[model samples]
Every structure is written in C-alpha cells, then in structure tokens.
Target: MKKYHFIAALLFCSILLQAQERYFLNSDTRLYTSTSTSAEFLGYFKYGAEVQLLSKNENGWYKVKADNLSEGYVPEKFVGTRLNAADIKTVDNENPVLAGGDQYYGGNHLFVLVAGLKARALPDKTSKIKEILFTGDPVPVNYLPKNQDEWVNIGGNFDYENAKFTLRKFIGKRPDFNTLIKEFDKLNPDAIAERKTVAERIVELAWNSDYSKLAPAYQRYSEVVKQLNDPKLIADTELNVSIAKGLDKHKLPEQIVAFTQKTEFILKGIKTKSLFLTQKELVKTFGKPAKTASIGDECGVYLSDLFYYYPDLEVSVDEKQNKAEIVKVFINENNKMILNANSVLDNTITEKAFIEKYGTYITASIKAPHSYSLQFEDSEFRIEFKDGKLFFIEIFFYC
Candidate 1:
C-alpha cells in the first residue's frame, strides 16, 4: 500500500509539470541564436517547430529546447508560446466542411453569407481561398443539398445562439431568413466523415503551432484587414500595442514598429478609397494654411497632412531662393488626427500621376527640376524620369 501511494504521487507530479510547461511558437521566421547578435544564427526552426521554455534573460533572451533535442538560448522576441490541448480541442470541434454552392448543410451544420455577393475569404473574389474559414468568408456548411436551399442532418455542435450571431454578420437581419431553420435528423454520414478529417487537420496544425502550412499568413492577414473595410478596427492603439507585445515576446520591438506602420498605411489607403474623399476634402480636414507666399511659375505652397492626428506632427517645406521645391511630413504619434489635409489635396490634384503611383497615404515627397522623390515610413522608393521616359526604379527598407 505504501509503494502504490508513492507511485501515484509521482504520476500526479509529472502531470502537473507537463501542464505547466510552455511551448515556443514553432515558425520559420523565428531564428535561434547562441549569442544575441546578427552574427550568431545557430539554426532555423522549421515551420511549426515548438520548443519548451527553460529560462529567460534580462535582455529579452530565452533559453529553450530546440527540435534536435538540444538546449539553447534564443532571442525572446522571436519565440511564441505553444497552443495547449484545450485550445486544440476547441478548434477541432469547430472545424467546417468544404462544399460547392454558396450554402450547404450537413447534420445540424449550417452556414450562410451575411454580406458580399460571393462567399470567399481570398484577397480576390474567387471561391478557391484555402485559409481557415472565418466568419467573413469561406463559410462552412453541411446537410443542405447542393442544388436545394433546404438543409437536413446538420451535424455541427455549435450553440444555436452563437451560430445565429455569426450567421447574422454575413446575412444581416431578416425575418424570413430566421424561419429557414429546421430540425436536422438524417445527417449524411459521408459528410460527417469528411468533417472529422478537416477537424483533425485543424487540430493537428493548431496544436503543433504549424503556420508554415498556411502560405503567406502575414500577407493574408493584410488582405483580411482590407476586407473588413474598417480603418478603426486596425488603426486602434490597442491593436498596435498588441502587435508590439507579440513582437516584444520575441524581443523584436523594431520589427513591431515597422509592421505596425505598414499595416497602418494599408488601412489608411483602404479607408481613403472607401470614402472616395477628393484631394480638396483631405486638405480641409487636416492641412494648415501656408505662412509665406511665393509667386513663380514653379513656386507654390508645399503642404502635407501626414502627421495630422498623430501625437507629434512634423511638417517641413524647403524652397530654393524664392521658388517652392520640396515638402515633407512625418507623423510620430500612435493616435489618429488630421495630419496633412491641405497639402495632400493640393499634391493629389497637381501630381495626379504621382497619386496614381504612390497613393493618398503619402508620407514624404521631394520635387526638383526633372527629379522627384518619395518616402514611406522606414521604406524608400524612387522613380526617375528622363526625356519623358521612365529611367530608374529603386526600393529599399532600413531596420
């Protein structure tokens, strides 16, 4: 009896240790290093490779168990915590089946589109997007016949209220739509079998922290931001802070800033296009009037609203002798404000060609005889024209 009790106690302790253990974000982008410097690149973890956390350093470095069964110290900023069993189980149960037609049902499973003409989650409007089906597009369905609207044998276990909430976002409020619900009794066994396969795949990928299988996740994330069509959703300081925190976990604050800036720009462009705001409107909302007047064929007030709503708005204008030549604006704050309303309007109309190429979310620009310059935060791209023909194109980014 004493020996059996001791063994039982040992097993309980092992279980506790396993539960407390944390896994690293198994990804290709995370590079393991022996020393905290660019010169040290010990090895790269294959996509979805998880490591056990051992310890941490004051400089945001972490000691972890690499895949080769070796212990090493890696930059804390590049490591992400692994998903646990509960998270994996939840995703597994919620996985959806892929089928033809906008709406299909299988044994208590039902999916509906609340908005947009076609059901899809791709950047472009096509039915072949391969990402995990979310509320926005690539809706999952089961039970309903391919040709008919009526459904039978929907097999999903999602709560009815939660399912309704998700369904309403895509289909909108409608009394007739609500009446479409019916009891699912004769579930297609084949569909259930397929669903299990999908569920297993989702669980396996999610549990293993395997992101490599999802091609271009970041780019797809960008596309999702665009599809949501709400700048406020992506522009919030909390989102930026959250991203910063994620990067901070890996100890990459600089990368956090760059990613946030680029995402902000993309969101701004989407907002600008959605609103259809003209150049004049942009200036009225954010630009400050010119202080000095210069009268010349090539002389004009160079304005910019890049820093309108930011915490610190930096604007500068430089002219050669008495003629206007250059204008630039820099926004250093995290919040939204009317940064460059007037200058953007003037420039948009005056340099239509440039607006077509650079977009209204312009951060910087320079004008010289036969020369033009443009800059997006942390990114420099130049286009040169000679004898009415484009001559050179250069693009680069700085960390």
Candidate 2:
C-alpha cells in the first residue's frame, strides 16, 4: 500500500511540474527547429530571456516559447532555472580598467579594432600610418598619455585611441592598482634620467587607466588660461595621501572562453574558411547554396562534393571516400577578414618572409626544381608570390 501511494504521488508531481515548466536563458543561443544544430534557425534568444518550456525532443533539445510568442527549440544545457545576467562572464567585463589620471592608469592593455587598424608611424596625429592591426585585437602595450592626445602603437604605428574607444563603453576601475605601483617602485633604474622616464611611464598608466570612462561627445575646445600654470609634477602630500584611503579591492570578472559563431575559424591557429559543419549546418547557415551542376555559382562548383557561394564568401566541402563529410572549405576574395590579424594580404613582402612572420605554414610543396608553393591540408591556405613578393592567396578546408 505504501509503495503504491508513493508511485502515485511521484506521477502527480511530474505532471504538475510539466504543466508549469519555465526556463531561463543562461547564455546567448540560437533557436532551432529540430534538436540538432542543423535544424532551421528560428531566431536568437539573448542572455536573460525568459522562456516557457513546452516539451523535450528525444535528441536533447527543449521546445520553448519566448514572450514574443516565437516558438523554437534550444539546446538543453544553455537553458537553466536562473535568468541572472551577472553570471554571464566575458573577457572585457573581467579585469576592468579602473581609475586613471594623468599620472596613473588602472588598466594596462590596448584593444584594437576587428577589421584591422593602422598604426601611425609617429606620435603626431598627421603622421603616416605604418601598420595595420586586425580587428578585435588588443596589443600588449602601455600608453604615454600627453595632454588631450591619446595614442596606440601597432607595429610602429602611433594611431589615435579615440578612433576605436570613442566613448566609455567598458571602462571601470583596475583591480590591481596597488600591486602595479609596488612593482613599479621595485624597478630600480640606475640613472636618474632612466628612473624619471620609467616612473613617468608608470604614472601615465594610472592616469590613462580611467580614460575610457568618457561618454559625452568628446570636445576639443581651445582653452585660454587667465594665468600661466606650472606644467610640472608638483607634489602635494596632503592631496596625494587620500588616493589610498577608501580603495576597496576591485574585483575581476571570472575568466571564460566564449562560444564560437558559425563564421568563426574552427581551428585555433590555422585560419581558413572552413567551418567543420555538416550538410544540415551548412544549409542552415548559408541557406541553399549552388549544389547541382545545372544550377551553380557563376564561379562554378562541380569539382567539390558540395559548394556554397556568397560574393564575399565561398565554401567547398571535401568528398569522403564513402561517408559524406564536410571537412574542408575554400575561400575566395569576398571576405578578406579570413586573413588573420596582422597577416595582411599585401604584396610588400616575399612569400618566404610572410611565412616567417606566420611561422611554417600548414605545409610546403615544391612546384618545380627551384620554385614551390606553400600549403597545408587540401582546405589550407596557399600563398603565391610574384617577383619574390606576395601576390595572391587561396585557401581550402579539410574536415
């Protein structure tokens, strides 16, 4: 009798929970039609979206409804009971730069743009751009802030910081101010001139640390001072003493690797157009690509197992011996961002020199007794040089 009652109670609780199922977005995920990722994309569910759980598919997906009445299936793991946005950790949110002044900076790194930025050859604003730092890149650099001008060095280029960080979007207090100051003090430079320069660099970091906090439309208004002011580092113990008074331990966000998007390079270092997707994932992402020989991309797609065409992007899947797999993708000139950061596609350097900068490429092939082409797997990138200078690049994918 007790066993029978327990079973009955368990069944009732399961039914009640099922009737009122609720789920919260733990991370950003795409809503799909079926349980597999290759399913049709319904829409994007951002972090902290509240959703109503309907039922589970046998393939480990949860059917849910958003407030907009849009229904779709999302992966089970990315959904949870909590809709806490604070728990979502990203790199920029962690170790946020804190209080910076002309003499001190909280954060110490420079983040460049995603589409590559030109590094000016000199400190002056009108100086020529010397190098391009690819987009979403951060340089391991310390700044030397002077007056209203802010500069960043990318491969000998002294570019303006304002170009990228126009407003205070992710600025905050640095978490390691005390430690940095202590380390600076410990650096015992021998000469007075060297000591002064080193000390100035340290102070400049702290001063520029809080620079990213500006939100107002930045103004470069000319100033007229009524009286000449001393432009030296005049020390005042009373004013300087308060800086260490109320500083609470600034905390950093938890470190986490972000999820990759479909367009991202799957391999860590070797950058190609390959996505490592199946036929379903490919269709879901690129929509229907030119497949049959009768209907094909103007550029053509008969040789490969399957081909996809976009003006800026082209993909070709390798045909396995028997099994159908998409391991490799070929990229054309449409999306040049595939050229990794700092790896500019310029005819300024020889193929050998470019390979030196990137290290030994995927592989090297001998085209003739004296000449040869560098390659990796079938889907790897190829570098072609003309008159000893790089001329063109081609890439293919191999799953």
Candidate 3:
C-alpha cells in the first residue's frame, strides 16, 4: 500500500504570491531578449518590482513578462521571491574584532554565494549596499546558518541563497537500485558515526509526500551505503553495472530509490565542517590562478580559461584579507568528466542514474532539448540537454 499526503495547501504561501508563478526583482534588474546578456536589452525592472513568471529554461534563466508587458529572459540572480536582504536571518555577530573594523573570513568556513548581489552592512532590508558580488562567488563566512538553508551571513555582509546564484551540478545518468542494494548488504560500516549519520538522514527523508523525489532518494541511499563500506564503490563501474541489473522494480520504487543524496551532501558538509577547501588548500592545489576577475564588486580568480578547460572549478578570494572565501566546482560541457568528486558519470545514464549521483535534476516536466534547474537550500544544479545528448552539469557548494 502507498501512503499519500497532500502538501498543496502548505504550498499556498508560494501560490498566493502569484496567480500563476511570479517573481520579484532584487535590484534594478535587466531583462534580455533571451538567456544571453548579449541579446537585446528588453528593459529593466525597478527594485522590488514584481513580474509575472512566464517560463524558466533548463539553464535556470527566466522568461518573464516585464513591467511594460514585454517578455524576455532574466538571469535568476536579480529575480527572487524575497524582496530584500533583510529577509535572511543571521546569527549574532558580537565578535569584538568585527567592531574593530577587521573583516576577515573565520578561515574555518567557506560559502558559495549564489547570486550576483550587493553586500549590505546589516541583514535588515533597509541596510545600504556596501558592495556588489556576482553569482558563483565563493564567499568566506563568519558563521554558518544553524539549521535553515535559505539565508547566509557572508563576511559580515548578508546574502540570500538565490536560486540561480548558488552551487549546482549538471545531470548525467542514474544508477539502478536493484543490484546496488545487494552490494550495500555486502559492505561493512566504515565508522559507527557515519552509519549513524546515514540512518538519521534516512529518517529525515522517509516521508511519503514527494515520492517523485523519494524513489531517486532510495537509489542514493544505496550508493551511500556502498561508499561507506568502500570509498570507491561507484568508481568501479564493472561492479555498478552488475548491481543495477539486479535492482527490484517494486511498488513505490521511485520513493524508495530517491533516498540518500540529501543525507550524503548534508553529512559531508556538516561533518567535514567544510569540505576539501580553504584559502591555502586551493592555492596549494592549483597554484595562483592564471588570471583574475572582478565581477560586480567582488574579486575572483579563474584558474584556467573557464569556458574552455576545467570549467568545474572556481575559487575566489578576498585578497586584502588574503583569505580564500569562495570555492565552486561546476561540471559543464566544457569540462565533462566521467569521474567527479563523488561518483563516475556519463551521458548514457537515465534520470534515475543522475538522481543517485547528483540528486534530482531533470524534472519529470523537462526532457531532451530543454533545460531545468533544481534549487537546494545551500546549492543549485542545472541540467541541459540538446539533440538527445546531455551537455551541461553545474554545481555550486555553499555553506
């Protein structure tokens, strides 16, 4: 038997905001004729202005009916459901050093700021813009949000986690759950603590509400179990293909398969306190970048040609403070790889394979030739396909 629960009533908050779907402009935002900035400049929306949402493309760009009743594409950064910076709640900032006018990242934390935004002195809506930061800026954080995912206080400046501006991953294939679990049973727990984390995350996602996400979640759950037993479980494709062939397609399999990705990312982010990054670790890994960039008001470093090679990595720092504040790894066509930081993936895989590796991306409504973006509280992923081939995969890591 399947358990069903209706969340449409709870979703009314979003529904009431728009008769259809609607969004707000965070700044005096521009609207383009299409997704590219080089396209025609349709017009601009005033700060805090609301616009009717027409459609959202696979790459996370929005096609909106602007104030003048014109339609065009707007990047997701300047457009959001929230009206102001003050909407994000911040942890107490009583550090005496902050009062002394010293602005340095805590060195213990790194955050990826998802929007190209203006930094405000306070987290309140009325605060003046201190500076502007472009989308994908790896920001150093003084404090991490306790349990919520929507807001981040970065370097004493407040930034909201915008849908387009955060960390994301591109989609590939999904792993079949049938054989994967048999492998799961074969492995022993690496650590009691990690096993506990996995169990807890499982409990957290067990609700039957979004079975669309649940089935894929179960697939991921198995992957995590295998990883804990053998760090390279997914890396061994010979073993993985065999595992997939054995997966059972039972009732409510979608909900069951969709289980583990959240747990994997959350545990990774929380347990590591931060993951494989810091100002020093980045420089040490890739050396000083080949070039420097100034997007909006923030300084960023491009380790390479970006659109050409290794598009997956982004590192930005606050040079004055000599701190590496932003770190990102976006997997796109320019830097396609079989083995990512966590799993091995390629184009031949289905949406299911992708869900296990990167969680849900290409939604049921999106398919070949169209793109879609999935927003997480801390990160975002965009999946794009064309001519029946998957070409883009992007991920941003924000804490």
The candidate maximizing TM-score is 3
Give one digit per residue, the lDDT tens place, for model 3 in 1-399: 011112222223323536555567665446677788778664434354566677755386888754323457777766677765564322223221111122323232232222225554333334446555432223443222222322334442111222111111210112223333344345465654454344323322322123333444345455555655665434432223322332222223344224313321111122111222344554555566766665442222232222212234554555444444323444333233333255443456554345444432223221122344444334444555444345555544343
RMSD of each: 23.1, 24.9, 22.8
lDDT for each residue of candidate 1 in 168-222, tens digit (9 for 90 to 100): 1232111121121111112243454443333323222221232232222222233
Expressed as tens digits, the lDDT of each residue in 1-399 for candidate 2 is: 565455335434434554565566666566677788887765444454555677865577888754323457878877787656467622223222211232332223434322224554333335456555432233433221211233322221112222222112212232243454454456554344444433433333433333221111011000101011223222211112122111112112121011111233422233434334454454555556554322333544224545455432345544352112332332233222233344454435554454444432222211121122333333334444555554444444343
User: Model 2: runs farther than 4 Å from truth?
Assistant: 1-275, 278-287, 294-304, 309-353, 362-381, 384-399
- The candidate that wins on lDDT is 3
What are the per-model numbers of colliding residue pairs? 36, 35, 45
Q: Least accurate stretch of 10 residues (summed lDDT) in model 2? A: 217-226
Computed on alpha carbons, the lDDT of every model, listed in order, comes to 0.32, 0.38, 0.39
Model 1 CA lDDT for position 78: 52
